[model samples]
Target: MKTVISLLFIFMVIVGCNSTKNVVTTDTVSKISDTVKIANEELEYEVIIIDPGFSSWIAGRALPRGYYSEAYLENKNQFYVAEWNNRVAQPMQYDSNLYLFRIDYDLTIRYGYEVNYLIYNYFIYFQNRYNQRLGGFVPKQ
Candidate 1:
């Protein structure tokens, strides 16, 4: 059986800005459908991330692939996933649109490098794009 983990981000333009000051203009948003699929056939696991500017952000703003080890990425992903799930559980406290679904990340299973890399960068893109922090460390390119 295939364990497909889909983390869907509902895209919406926020008119007003708050403390974060990460203003997303119309030009900044990608016109094309930015759908990224991270799959490991051996593990029978797949992760689909659907967000507007994620493809462009990953190509231009994300750090190089070799910059961080798989272990590091996995660790960061664990923390990010935890915070993401927390927000998903509380719709009233957090934005229901943004935190629509909880990410199913199993720490025991080794999802390989590609899966971890994309997941980690997606978290970074998510935090910077949405002006929300999931972990203690600052989200950087």
Candidate 2:
């Protein structure tokens, strides 16, 4: 219950191969404070999502809670995490910025409904926003 989840999301603006500068636009700045924390005390797991616009996006675009079963979310999350980790490993092939960190999601762990829901939606948001596909089916709300 006391476990602290700390995840950093550094979104860089890639102008060109030569540019190393990180740009923070007005939209980015506004969304900077939009962080969503999902924690299950009984399960002792926590997920913190600091991606810009995710808070608002989830509120407006994501499907309502319980729309999909926890099992479904877990199944989708397992597949998405696998693909995400694969991309993170092969940075040369995938955009390193998009796949910066490898997600540590264990299938054996029962992360409950809220944890799975947030993680699943974040994956959908990520895929849609970045134009990346983690699975065969198109990422949807």
Candidate 3:
């Protein structure tokens, strides 16, 4: 009887601990999602503010095959996040889920000026590195 009582107490304690841990984990995940959403919104707003015609250009473009890999885009995005923070004087976070690569792919396809891969990368690298200032100056075709 004593053994049964001790076992029951231990089980209850374990279950209680697990439930609390789960709650904490869930809360953390929710907060993270919220932060991501806000950051994505801010990113979108900044991009539009800097390049008002970008959306229209993107709508008319198609993504090219082998033009960019997921891994490469992700690395660029991470670098962009760091550069953006330096430009904006705030730590702007980013996630791969933000669809930045998709936007880039579309923009690459819609680029009006004749450009090869090398020229295109230089243009985009400067645009992003400068937080769209270079992009705004470049006349879109």
Which pairs clash in the backbone of model 3?
none
> Which ranking of candidates, highest TM-score first?
1, 2, 3
Clashing pairs for model 1 are none
- Report the C-alpha lDDT of model 1 over 47-111, residue by residue, as the tens digit: 66777678888899989889999889989888888898899899999877678776777766666
Clashes of 2: 0
Runs in model 3 deviating more than 4 A are 1-51, 60-66, 90-141
TM-score of 1: 0.75
Residue by residue across 2-121, what tens digits does model 2's lDDT show?
111222442211121232223311211122366765544434444567776788898899999999997799889888888888988998998776677767675655556766777788
Q: What are the per-model numbers of colliding residue pairs? A: 0, 0, 0
Cα deviation of 100, candidate 3, in Å: 18
Better of 1 and 2 by TM-score: 1
Candidates in order have lDDT scores of: 0.66, 0.64, 0.28
TM-score of each: 0.75, 0.73, 0.30
Best by lDDT: 1
